[model samples]
Target: MSKTALIFWGGWEGHTPARSANIVKEMLAGHGFDITLEQGTSVLTGSDISQFDLIVPMVTMSTIEKPELENLVAAVRGGTGLAGFHGTMGDSFRNETEYQFMVGGQWVSHPGNIIDYRIDIAKPDDPIVAGIGGFAYRSEQYYMHVDPSNEVLATTTFSGEHFETIAGVVMPVVWKRRYGKGRVFYSALGHTADEFDVPQMKTIFERGALWASR
Candidate 1:
């Protein structure tokens, strides 16, 4: 059966959310998802969110109103899966604790803005990450405040080169968790749509998105 998705994008321009939303829209469409792309969070209230099997929010650092926010939270709690990557998901809604709780993590810093790093596959057996090996990566090495209950799939180590205080710190790069009855997945990869050019990065996110919608 084909699944449906609602992808609402555009918050901070630096995130290039429009490009991100279009990219994921294509990716999911190829996987048999019926996608609806919209700008701004207002789409949440305008649409019957519960009918969609998945919801992808590509908005970063944006304020969502109480009604819109509550509507989204309610829809997901009733089993609409949520999934996204990088700041679009992790760094979104700084003031909403409930949103962060549902996401399982919030971005704190990227120690080294954009540098070469390596990702370690923590759960090689998990379907979302299985068969994918750790590879050299170039992106913001995200250091986040994460939910301890998350099922971490991948991680990165801080060398103290950028932020000396947190040297040797291991941070999650990809994770998935349950939000009520909905499956939630997030990755600190894809700082911009360009990052998807990396096969490993793209594969991880695509597979993870499918898993999230499960």
Candidate 2:
């Protein structure tokens, strides 16, 4: 049976959630997933979220109703997968501690906003990053508060050019973890849909989504 995915996109327009949703929808569909694309977090309320194999939240810096947030958490705890990229996953629901805990990270800042940086594959043997070497890209280098339990797959060193205090700090750029019985994956890339045009970034997102799905 083909897997199902629900993609909720909307919140901060600066993130271009709509375009990102479309890109993800196409990618997931190509992988044989039945997609349900919706805007806003209302769709999560009282939904039988466990039925879907994967959930992708393209929302950024938004608030979700308590009951809806509870439902989404329950679903993941019950084995439904959750996967997303950039602030869509990491920087969302800023006020919700449980939500942040489930995601395993929260974006704190992006120093130097859209500057050139290098992403190093921390685990080259991992299938999600296999054959991909440390590559350079120009974008926001996300500084995040991450859970130590996260299995970090990739990282980037802070150049200290933007924020002198955090200079040389190695921050996680890609990671995967388990929230209860569900799998969770996140990448601090994809500030825009066009970022997906990069072969390595695209492949990482694609493979990470597949890996997170049930």
Clashes of each: 0, 0
Model 2, residue 115: distance off in Å is 0.2
* Candidate with maximal TM-score: 2
How far in Å is the alpha carbon of 169 misplaced in model 2?
Answer: 0.2
- Per-residue CA lDDT of model 1 for 90-151, tens digit only, reads 98899999999999999999876999999999999998888888999998899999999999
lDDT of 2 by residue, 80-179 (tens): 9999999999888999999999999999999899999999999999999999999998889999999999999999999899999999999999999999
Instruction: Give per-residue lDDT, candidate 2, residue 74.
Output: 93
Pairs with steric clashes in candidate 1:
none
Top model by lDDT, which number?
Answer: 2
Model 2 clashing residue pairs (backbone): none
Candidate 1 Cα misplacement greater than 4 A, ranges: none
